[model samples]
Target: MSAHSQHNLPPSLTGKGATLALDGHDLVRMTEEHGSPLFVFSERRLRGNARALRDAAKGGHARARIFFASKACSNLHVIKALREEGLNIEVNSGGELWKALSAGFAPGEIVFNGVAKSVPEIELALGHGIQSINVDSAFELSRIAQVAAGMGKRARVTLRLVPGIGGGATAGIQTGSEKSKFGMGQAELKEALATAKANAAHLDVAGMHLHIGSQVLDLPDFLESVRFTAEQAKAIGGELGKPLQHLNLGGGYPINYVHHNPGANAGREFDYTPYTATQSAAAMLGEVAGAAAKALGPDAEIFFEPGRAVVADCALLLSRIENVKRRGALQWLFLDAGYNLLIDAAAVRWYYHMVNASRIDAAPDTEFRMVGPLCDSADCYFDVEGEYLWADLQATLTGVAGVTPEILAALKAKVVRLPETRSLPAATGPGDTIALLDTGAYTLEEMFQYCGRQRAKAVMIGTDDRIVTLRDRDRPEDLLDAAERQGIVRTVAAE
Candidate 1:
């Protein structure tokens, strides 16, 4: 009847009676020391993920390069650890570029990628001589060329082509569709290539790049994307009269998030059979070997910019239940952590498996409506939008003519996002520590300070069994420090 016996816990997590340990460190004790609403990352998992990805890439192609997408988890310690494992860095903004440099990544080991690259960001990349700037559009290409011309430097550039292929869990994350505002289409790409050739003095066309989407579960979509990119590379090389130096197959490798339990109402909408790094690499490299090799030659490198796959499952968020309420036949458990800490949960209705850390061995026979401390109604873990739509549909169809029960059931199935309830220990309530699993990626990076709640602290469990603080808990003054710096608010001391 224990939770572990019923649920598939992550590899780094183990549960015993009244205790939940992450890689042999007790979660309850850590929460007691560090306070609730904390993030704990496992160094062992981070290094393992890096090694697995690197080895997988090498298995597919000898000249493969893996770049840890730092925008996923920009904590300096995490970046340094991945770098030590022989992965380069991929950044999206000037701030991320600076973080990459501060993390000790050489300019040659970094690649800048973004849609809106300001003048200052372009200058910083050129000044440091970063490996390549992944150009998002034709206009950006001309802008980069102009900036490089002004800087008196030849900027290495890669065209981010839109393969017109789209695959992702949600529309918000889908970046490769024809309508998506991410990369250049065929006409724009042709224009970019011509512009690069024209501005040969300032722009060095190094390679081509395309990102299908994040959390893409379809392997055939990857194969199709790789095949398309390879074909384009071949034609591009022929047009330019020189082979490409690299092919940046931007990463969207998925990771398993749902841990199934027969007795629990864990949402199945987020579940997918994620491809292993090796499988993804092989699919891409296999396509590359066919046509792309004929143009780029054997020495051409293959680059992967993995973000979520590298870190999503390597950490968990620990939250404390601060209050409990019961209405009719339902129970609600409110935790201290909310959209401010894990924005995706509210923004996209993202799901993270919840575990009762305080009662690890207890049977999860009770279903509770789990919610965060945020004042907003959408702050709960359930799909708020989906629930609203379902309710509206039911009300609309209540007296509609010829609306059969079967039809209503079918409509409800399509409208409802699963796991409308959460299964937890029956005794779960106030003061209980709940561990939200697989929250490593996107949570802290997208965190915001809303409703005056201070941001939480993060700690890493080192491979050496030492717990190091990755980030300190935000102080009350830290909130106003930004306003103070901008002169929006002046502190009159000792008034």
Candidate 2:
């Protein structure tokens, strides 16, 4: 009779008695053997998400190609799985490019994108002959030209533009507005293209890249950006003395994390709906193509970079309950997986639907305040950035009535909200594994060790039901400093 028993659970999870299995593999056994606080990814779901995005983008434009955002989840195995589904790789840095190459992503199938690319990173990207490098700023474009010319290779690139559109549930994730640190404005875009044309011997301007934002729910935002891109692309080839070859629209299609579908929060047990993208990828892509088909024509191919939408729902974080206690009219549950492992919990207050995997079918009738393992008070599992709570935390902490922008950001980044009361089962306790749903994106790569905890294992349910380790759980030695790995270990004798 509980909504938590059904809607919040992912498609790959099915209940059998008290056990919840993922694709016929027991989750409890998985946590036991592989260790607690593990990342369990569904290969089936990864492929399905990729195919769905590809289908969506190609619906209107058959030449549409998808580039999986590597910053979402850079696990080599996961990257390869997504690539097999017809998605190419788009990396944000040199490390990601290295991993993409190791995963066997062809040079032409990869794209390098970042604001502050180092000389060595540019050299590496050019040397590898990746598909295209998105130039974030004019300075970066000049730097790329130098690197490419020195390497005796033509650096293929696209101009990333700020189109005055915003996205994401929070301001932090919104990337396309004028306030954003990424991409060039219209004037800058024209200048950058002219610069690339003048230096055609080193840098080649492929097309323009526009991303209104990440976690976008509305289709109109995308359509506006697409039209703007086509308009820009119309002017690009003329300036560069050649036709535009591709248009890269960076991906920000949101995934509904809390409710089964976006905007279904009314009857839901929890009040969390990250954002909504009402149209399917194919539907949205169709509309964009329809809007831009005239200006872009057939020659300029379309490219989509989908990071969160492709991988965010393919995996979930599995952690065991470590302890339970009462704290001032609230029940506090300590989780082995906390903000350290799930950075979004504390970073931008990104919510992930939680279900007790050990009792996945049990009725949820209790509320608990989830706490992480860190010593910092700011390390709790929830953040309160609402209007009233901001006032309350500010007034209570510093006794200030009105606040400044600097103080507001600081408090928002580090404030104790209501701690997100979850209606988990009454029997949820220590050793029971808690499944955080739709965590396949940005969780693993952003994870860190704050409370001296080593990073967790990323285990995949391979084809034919085989359990393969995509990434190893960090051993104590892995997290140790030079002194500890040598001198400290030698000093501490085992009895």
Candidate 3:
């Protein structure tokens, strides 16, 4: 299979055993060209997704700047591609800030976000002269003003507010909760804006920002947030006697993964899109923008910082199978990637839908208890309703890496162990290939080396079916090199 064909792997792939065909090339091609346990991103799909979001916001009238949340897919290459398309950047941390900067994102084109900003980090941003920092607290505003005054520069600050409407289905992620630690309250925001006005000579209050939460599926929740933001801006304008320059409704739009389906193995579905047609989450955003214009007048520019929805479907993770064993009725299927590579799996119970990349239309007739190669027992993606099968002597493992801790715990508790088998065939031995689907977001930055294992490799498939190594697999020597830089001097005198 070629790279283009593999990149176009269908939504539902079916075949006996764990076979992965990405773009057009099967797991064999991916492994030979790139390497196993590789993160392959589709450039065509990425640009298309970005363009969709931009079009959604503009409604074909004017261009609406869409900032790719670097926190989602912070790979420099990923950032570079998005930047090339004229998409702005939204960064959550100093590391992401550096990535965006290295990817050629202009200082003025980036939006610095996050509730907690360290002094040194803030100083770095102040020095770099990024466009605006979304201030979460009155104290942050004070710090920015102080830092800006010290540097003899003005800080473009945006106040992040809690819209009071919970976002996403997960109660824990809903940032709009009054109890959440995300944005500044209305009272604090008022005081912060007042303080900014008092220090207008040193601080420039750029806009008001809000990120309700991630994986938000409900359009009304976002629209309501927009309306609330517009209303608040209007009230603030009344106090300041000027309409704010920017109103950023942060992105948390949901994507429909295979996990949305029922069953224990369907994985954890946080953001579910029951519909996927003409009126999508993007359309809802446009409606929200129109509503904001109505409430806050036409001058206020509404900004959206969407991360997952843009990159989720644009990338996939391909892994190779190592072993398959059956403990009593429980089947243990091991792969090459684990939580170390999928940092998000440690916290968020997000499961990327997986299927044989080779069998685009394969039926969901079999299931398996999928586990990674990590020594930790918590690393597993067990599907209670899924069965494992192998045919054609192709011994390969395929599935998404980075199963969330929540789901792993459930797997640990035997929530997805195989049921009594009537006449199931014996499992295949090692040497099979498995692939994980829709892992484009935060996998790379999250992956860490643990237990002295090899660092995973990253590959990119080009328009010409050529495979380019994005990040090479780490060797034991690489670890020693890293350790040497950490000032760990070797024992000169032998014991």
Each candidate's clash count: 0, 3, 33
- Return the top candidate by lDDT: 1
**lDDT leaderboard ranking:** 1, 2, 3
lDDT per residue (tens digit) for residues 318-395 in model 3: 777688787866566677877777755444544555544433333333445667788876566532232232211112
Question: Candidate 1 residues 334-441, lDDT tens each?
Answer: 999998999888777676888889888887778889999988998888877888998898999987999998888777656665457788888999999999998899
User: Which scores higher on lDDT, 1 or 3?
Assistant: 1
CA shift at 393, candidate 1, in angstroms? 1.8
TM-score per candidate, chains pooled: 0.93, 0.89, 0.82
Query: TM-score of the candidate numbered 3?
Result: 0.82
Model 3, position 311: C-alpha lDDT score: 84
List clashing residue pairs in candidate 1: none
Q: Using TM-score as the measure, name the better of candidate 1 and candidate 3.
A: 1
